[model samples]
Target: MAVKTNCNINGIDYYRLRVTIGKDRKGKDVIKNFYGTSKTDAENQKDGWMKNKLLGINHISIRDSLSMAMFNWVWDVLKVSGIKVTSFERYEGIYRNYVEESSLGFMILEDIQRVNVQRCYNKLHEQGKSYSQIKNLHKVINMFFKYAVIEGYLLRNPCTGIKLDVYKKEEDVGEIDLFIEDEGTVETFTDEEIPVLLEGIKNKKLKIMVKFALGTGLRQGEILALKKTDIKNMVVQVTKTLSFAKLYDDADNYSYETIVTRPKTKKSIRKVPIPTELKKDLAELNKIRIEEKLKLGELYQDNDLLFPSETGTYIDSRNLLRSWKRAFEGIDVPYKKFHALRHTFATQLIKNGAQLITVSRLLGHASIKTTEIYAHVTESTKADDVQSLNSLFK
Candidate 1:
């Protein structure tokens, strides 16, 4: 009978299958070991290899290494129990976009060399993927390999010790007259630029939404899911998040659905206090909504959402992007994302001397280290510093 043993290497667990294949020509019993991410895969590989050995057609069990492709990774994710629905969906999107479609993703787990992985990373960088996004890709890749190593799918993780650049663009953005380093870092609009941005946005609901994001730094889904009941005494309780998900019909037609889920993390459920101005804004907005409801009467769809689409449906991110772009039109400043508002808020607080721990707590981050990225100043601040040289020149 074939038996399995549990072992861990480099902190990753694996199952080893062992079997005796009779005596060799040297009069010694030949034992073979096959490894797998799962006992079933290991056992099957051992049996298959043993059968092929008798026919003098067996290789080094090279075929035992599974190909970590999009479809296969997805099945692995589904089989792994207790993953949050939102996390699973995010992982699915990452795989389909970066791995399953990339050249590196098509190779067998054993065959993916460091050079191949490096090439893929370079390609993503060349495609203008943000440093944070590339980091996210790397994180997903690391996760896949960690599971692969634990299950013994591969003898080792290919992502290990790959020499790569992080935030290499810093050199190009490093030139500055101020004490700050010269080079592009995290993007954000200056305090002055924010007013211009808010003023240019034509959509009233979106303007308030942007204000709420700047004030609280809440994620798009969290902002979209906000309700009247979630707020009290200027404190907003983040309870749920809503994201767009697609549904298929019997005939294979696709329609979009809103997948409402819990907050992203345990820390994400923290309460955020709003400024007094924002509280007044909310009150005024609520009165407007009440009037709207009374006017629309039977035509109104009342979900009690703080911000919803005109017809009271979930706001689509793509449509939100269009609104974001329109808000920047006729503005002389360089374009930044709607997300930059959150960044702007963080940087402004940092400039005014907010502690990193305080920022981390307000941002609902799991760790203080995650909030460290917001400590850097923007180029606009440096430009303002240069303007002060006029006084020194005199």
Candidate 2:
């Protein structure tokens, strides 16, 4: 229960003080003072305080409260709770962007109201943010408010009732290309440009990497992280990824690190068969590494890294990107991304009349639907097969 009290101010009666019974940090009842002008104002404020207390809102002011910095607090909570690294990364990105651009940065957590949030959203939209981005922003905002409500920051979440026209402004951008019928997105590499592109890369290491990617349908990270132990018979086991490390302040050069992480999905951690033609190439690569190891002697610690640097150190992703760009100078290809090699592998598999299931396995796709993108590319191949079978029947 809360009580309102009045005192004389400049010879006039005014509700200058309000006292509310609330739990302190120890959950014991404590009296809190709220400043107000009128008796009704003081009583209303007291009622709201009691309601908030029942809801378990934090008694501390937003500026002083631990929940004030939504980004930091949420990340700490999620990290301690053992959330997945990839998901936490995305959440962190969203929160970072919001704090940097939204009015939420200027406001204390206690001052966050529905109108304030609405204004923030409008300003963001005016700044030319896409509808999808705005929706994501709203999602993070809602998540912050939801956590606040659950943690007893407020009696009710002010963000609950507001709705936005997120999807209604529909404009049809014509039918998408049906080349890759099952894949929601299209990725096509004009085969005519393959030879011209292959002739450009003079570096044997970079060439081996590019050719291996084209043959195996492995991601850049997965391919670069390949170790000598990963190869057995004609099978390659994907168990780790070489990712570009985040740029560190005061560092003159970027670095790469390998993490023994599973692929994006269960299917992504699959064994892919090496083509018979590349067996000799693989053997040569081993021989070169062995000779290099002997020459380096004690200097070489045997990191077992398949794609080591010129000095037998770990190969950085930035180096790979630079090498790939130099290779692109010789070939005029429509595709500019490094991952296009994986796409090329998928396209070739479909064109060679391999089943979707086999293609899915080779590509380490989690779903058959993911591999079905080749179904569109295989239309001509499938039709040619059908025609040949009909000729046999005749």
Candidate 3:
């Protein structure tokens, strides 16, 4: 090792230290440079590097920063991990939106401490980011740091002891509100509202779509990904879901696409029994589709979807949501989200004596705990059950 004083590079003066850390596979010397404002600073960096090498944390190059390593990890590890494109985009978004330009991203990978990770999360929480958003950010960074530790780029994970629950406000503490979508509150439609809503929708296809959602409890994405072959013997097989997302390319240019992938979890892959009444409506819709396809001939871009756009390609989810909202015009009932159709299905099932476990499977929930939210028995049901006991007193 040699320390050179008063070195000038890029018009900046610094003390530079050069050292031969190791050899390559061909037995050639591997040289490294450490620069700092003073001789003590430069020597301290060199000593730290030597100590890390001795402690078996040696894979990371001194020049690697948090953003540099994170991007490489995302491409090399996550892209090929068989995750959905939407999921991959979500991870990438977290990095770009929260970490890319922050001070945390520019820090040397090996030099980051737990305090640094905590500070980043603290800043995001203080900025009024939702608990879910910050939690996701923590999850990404924590996983990345774990990868660094396993790859020998880091001696220890800085995100080990970080706690996000402590930052959650009282309003955030509650059961997952199935009634909420996109930060909007949507209540389940009552029995009376259901008929009013159906009568109000002028679009023939949108009416059928709403009926399907209520009948089967499928999510919006799952409902949209349905095909003619997915339904048989009055049962709908849910193996996949469709999502619309704005994705960024290598040049950071964004474009929208409809992505189809397997259900988010294994539980989401299920077969739901279609109601007998819904069978006729589905058949009618199929007839309409066949008629349209034949009329269009080669103009149709058929992907064999149960619901397709005007050109027969995957329907944009945003457009579907917009159309759903518009269907309530001049209707007597209050507007509820498309997701409320699913909630109505579960709530009615529980009210009508469906077992909690059965409801869980029908909703494709990963845990029965999530299904507990729908276990609320209506006052009418409770009163009716109590009225039956009056016969014994008589």
Which stretches of candidate 2 lie above 4 Å from their native place? Answer: 1-68, 83-89, 104-146, 154-188, 247-260, 354-358, 366-394
lDDT of 3: 0.76
Please count the clashing residue pairs in each candidate, in the order shown.
8, 2, 0
Candidates arranged by lDDT, highest first: 3, 1, 2
User: Per-residue error at 32 for model 3, in Å?
Assistant: 23
Can you write out model 1's per-residue Cα lDDT over 272-381, one digit (the tens) per residue?
Answer: 88877887678667776777677778888888888866656567778998888887789866788776777777777787788878887887766665566676453357
Stronger candidate by TM-score (1 vs 3): 3
Candidate achieving the largest TM-score:
3
Rank candidates by TM-score, best first: 3, 1, 2
Please, what are the lDDT tens digits per residue for candidate 3 over residues 1-394?
A: 5544666643445676667867754678866566566778777777876786588553345345576567667766776787677888888888878876576775667667888888887887888877667777888999898888787767889998888786777645333422112222325898889999999998888899999999999999998999889998999999999988766553135687888888767888999999999888988888878887888999998988888776688878888888988888898888788889988898899888889899889888877766765654354457777999999988
Superposed by TM-score, candidate 3 places the C-alpha of residue 29 at a distance from the truth, in angstroms, of: 39
lDDT of 1: 0.67
Q: How many Å off is the CA of 282 in candidate 3? A: 1.2
Each model's lDDT comes to: 0.67, 0.62, 0.76
Candidate 1 residue pairs that clash:
36-151, 37-151, 173-182, 173-183, 173-184, 174-182, 174-183, 175-182
Let me know the TM-score candidate 3 reaches against the reference structure. Answer: 0.74
Question: What lDDT would candidate 2 get against the real structure?
Answer: 0.62
What would the TM-score be for candidate 1 when compared with the true structure? 0.68
TM-score of the candidate numbered 2?
A: 0.62
